[model samples]
Target: MTGTDTDSGRPLPRRLLAHVGVAALVYLGVCAVLLVWALVVTARETTDASMAGVIPFLATAPASLAFLMLPANSVVFFTAIAVGAAVNAAIISWCTRALRRGGHPDR
Candidate 1:
């Protein structure tokens, strides 16, 4: 019945930005889960129990992100970033659509 799909009564661009923000939060949650699992596995296997173990686990996620070190090649590094952005955009689009459909059940 309304021109805008958002129940918050904001413009489309703002809604899109909110959708992207939510998607980013989801992305960080996934990364945090990966980081926690890595740390837990490291914790279980080690007998020495030194501070050095904690440092590497904490640094890895940011280091890989900053250096684009995955796949270990220049071309692959750029490709990975592109792929990641595309995936995040897809997630935002999906979330926006879900919000549109769910928020206006009368339609």
Candidate 2:
């Protein structure tokens, strides 16, 4: 197995980048859906619908780190989410790879 991958025949780093990209895209998609919901709420309820936009950040465990590290700004929030997505992807990739190796349960 390459240091990057175990048996998938793909480089681990590339897989990691792809995972990060897909995960970040999914996170952004959630943000977009929430944004749309916020817009709809704003149009219907005449309220800012702050919760709609903030829920993803507040609810997603990974993003909470970014949210806390940075200020409450849109660009920063998105960046933080993307960064959080990468961190999450890396962690998940590592965990899954470790599990697949099948050495010791305690390891």
Candidate 3:
């Protein structure tokens, strides 16, 4: 039996929501890792006099691009992050819904 067969008893919206939660967690995990990496790099470069501190800023680019493009405030930063999470969740829901609808080929 295929994965879709197993989803027969469950509602699609519930499945989609579950997928959204999973996608949010995965997205947050990636952001958390990058944030930690940036912090570590910043700490290691503290004694240097180069422009390496920019690395942390670059690392957060994906999560904060909205804020960077805007007024660059805490509100904007949080908004960007929230928007990112929502977008990620929506994309995941769409893809998983398609998959559950048997949008795959079998050999």
Candidate 4:
């Protein structure tokens, strides 16, 4: 997917979005595997200090915040996650394109 088309010439964004949607599934699959690995590791480990800190933070921070501010933070977190996913998708797409163009047979 170069920015332009070979024949019918549809806008790149439409094509890119479709490609990204499919690619996102591959990304999600890898994430699911990692999540399962993390769960297995957590279950096997007797103690994890970083994980221990999360409960106190989640419990205390929300109670300390104003009710109105809580929703704003939730929106910000969701936006951040979306932005991060888009950036990751872009990087993956770029790398895939680059490798293909560079004639790396692995792809």
Candidate 5:
């Protein structure tokens, strides 16, 4: 379940790939829920109040530190989803790798 990291000689989990998948599920799952909520809110009669754009806007709010090359937008939400997932996966991987051996010292 672990592999050696080339850069720091740390034991990175092989499940890092699985972590990305899990992160994707979590990220997109939230986006889907927000999409549904947005639709529902749009459908309701709220006397000039609505959450159609605002609710789903969160999908693109957090820029991925790991993958920032692609512009996050509706036309590219597919890529953004993967980018978001990879960022979360990378963070988890780094934590697990660093924490595995008394934690790496910041340099």
Candidate 6:
């Protein structure tokens, strides 16, 4: 019944941002789990055979430092994952605000 509620009856961009934030949180959770697994593997005296298989791919990827240092590897991996997730959340927030200001209704 309000300007925000079109015939489809949606609350618009703020609502969408809430959804995006929830999804980003879920993704961050998964990343945390994976980082824990990586740390466990790295802590082992022997290198992870499975991880060794991916060495070529990782070697070609940016920030090769993760493949070299001990604690630094885990730190860099976890930091990058956290930072990337935060950046994704921020971009979603920015887009939502932009759409709302531009008068775009909910999809």
Q: Which candidate is the best by lDDT?
A: 2
Record all residue pairs in model 3 with backbone atoms less than 3 Å apart, i.e. clashing.
Answer: none
- Each candidate: how many clashes? 0, 1, 0, 0, 0, 0
Best by TM-score: 2
For each candidate, what TM-score against the reference?
A: 0.33, 0.51, 0.45, 0.39, 0.39, 0.42
Runs in model 6 deviating more than 4 A are: 1-20, 49-75, 92-107
Predict model 5's lDDT versus the native. Answer: 0.53
Candidate 4 lDDT over 2-106, as tens digits, reads 635453366776555556655655764554454445446557775663364233223323322333344545465334334444456666777766765686655
Candidate 3 TM-score, true structure as reference: 0.45
| Global lDDT scores for all candidate models | 0.54, 0.59, 0.57, 0.49, 0.53, 0.52
- Prediction 2 global C-alpha lDDT: 0.59
Backbone clash pairs for candidate 1 read none
Tens digits of lDDT, candidate 3, 53-96: 34434434554455576885546645665566556556666676
Q: Cα miss at 56, model 1 (Å)?
A: 20
TM-score of 2: 0.51
- Candidate 1 vs candidate 6: which has greater TM-score? 6
Error of 2 at 71 (Å): 2.7
- Give the alpha carbon lDDT tens digit for every residue of 22-99 in model 1: 665556456556445555765777664444333333433333355454556646543444455445556666776678
Q: For residues 34-97, could you state the per-residue lDDT of candidate 5 as single tens digits?
A: 7667657767867533547455455644643333455755556545544654455456555655
- Clashes, model 2: 1
Ranking 1 against 2 by lDDT, winner: 2
Clashes of 1: 0
Judge candidate 5 at residue 104 and give its lDDT. Answer: 44
- Which whole-number lDDT from 0 to 100 does residue 47 have in model 6? 46
